[model samples]
Target: MTKHRIYTTSFASVYPHYIAKAEKKGRTKAEVDQIIRWLTGYNQMELEAQLKKQTDFETFFAQAPQPNPSRASIKGVICGVRVEEIKEPTMREIRYLDKLIDELAKGRAMEKILRE
Candidate 1:
């Protein structure tokens, strides 16, 4: 089976778009970074390293230091698809991120966004 193109897409190429989406909605890059950190357990430094390396989405998720167990709680639609209902693991993780960013762009409180 052919792998999805996103699996090989460089994260760095998409990171700016994520930042832009949030910023256009009055959110900050720090908040986006925080969301990424919370989801993938990459500290600020490690996250920066991954961005610098321009890692692919598949590798980025696969090498995550500690993917948040709470991520299963991220239930919502992203790109018209339900994140919680996704059957593929990596795709689910990616959508979890998309949903979180959408919430952020919608101005959800950080505490609740983090599910803290």
Candidate 2:
């Protein structure tokens, strides 16, 4: 399957329409995406049709099944992180790492963290 890259600017442009569709169908954006992927295989028009037909969250999220940990682990590794490390990694951990990387790029605070 092809990975869909949702850019901030593009998402912002269509944000209202997506929100309106979600609200009209009483589904979350994630639910809408899942339903679309299942019903239409990424065809925008078919996705719209599925969204229009959906009347509730349960129907939209019918694809929800707890993923097998091994499958999830394999997918996570494909994106460049170990399964255990990512399982509970917080927004703070991510942001802090980003910040640290930025600081290192500008030549600050590298020795302290590297020596730990």
Candidate 3:
């Protein structure tokens, strides 16, 4: 099977969709950024820099600060696939972000979404 395009997709291109999804459900951009930071360790300035550069998803995660260990505890279906069951490392990382965003859009409490 051919590889998916999302791995090479620019994070900048995808960022807006995530924001829109969350905002449509009453979540703020700041809240979206907060969960992203909790997952990737990027501060506001760093996230801005990445978006400004149009970094690809691979590079975005590669250069991210060490992910919170607790992220492994995130579990559930995203796009109809169970995130924890994903075997591909990159896809799993992508789904982790997807799951977090899903939680935010679903109005999950921040502390719980962050796995605190």
Candidate 4:
């Protein structure tokens, strides 16, 4: 079966949209960065390096230093599909991120959004 096009898409390409969505809702880029750091455990420098490298989604998630255990708590629909119901590992990770961004855009508190 053909892989999803997003698998090969550079994470950097989509990151701006995540920031834009959050910023449009009166959120800050740092908040978006916090969400990414929380989910993937990437420090600021490491996250910047990944963005500079233009890493694809597959490799970006594959190389995550320590994906948070709390990410499994992320649940909701994104693009009409339930995030928890996504069976493919990579796709699920992507949707987990999408759901978090969705929550941020909806003005969810950072504490609750991180499931802390």
10-109 per-residue lDDT for model 4 (tens digits): 9999999999999999999999999999999999999999999999999999999999999998888899999999999999999999999999999999
Least well predicted 10-residue stretch by lDDT in candidate 1: 70-79
Instruction: Report every candidate's CA lDDT.
Output: 0.95, 0.35, 0.91, 0.96
What is residue 35's positional error in candidate 2, in angstroms?
Answer: 11
lDDT for each residue of candidate 2 in 1-116, tens digit (9 for 90 to 100): 43223211232334345445555645455543443343224355544554465423333223223322222222222125543455433322222223333333344443432322
Clashes (candidate 2): 0
What's model 2's TM-score?
Answer: 0.22
What candidate 4 gets wrong by more than 4 Å, as runs, is none
Q: Give a tens-digit lDDT track for model 3, residues 14-115.
A: 999999999999999999899888888888899999999999998898898867788899999999999999998788989999999999999899999998
TM-score of each: 0.98, 0.22, 0.95, 0.98
- The clash numbers for all candidates, in the given order, read 0, 0, 0, 0
Worst 10 residues of 3 by lDDT: 1-10
By TM-score, highest first, what's the ranking?
Answer: 4, 1, 3, 2
Candidate 2, residue 21: how far the Cα is off, in Å:
14
User: In model 4, how large is the Cα lDDT of residue 84?
Assistant: 93
RMSDs, each prediction? 0.6, 16.2, 1.2, 0.5
* Models sorted by lDDT, best on top: 4, 1, 3, 2
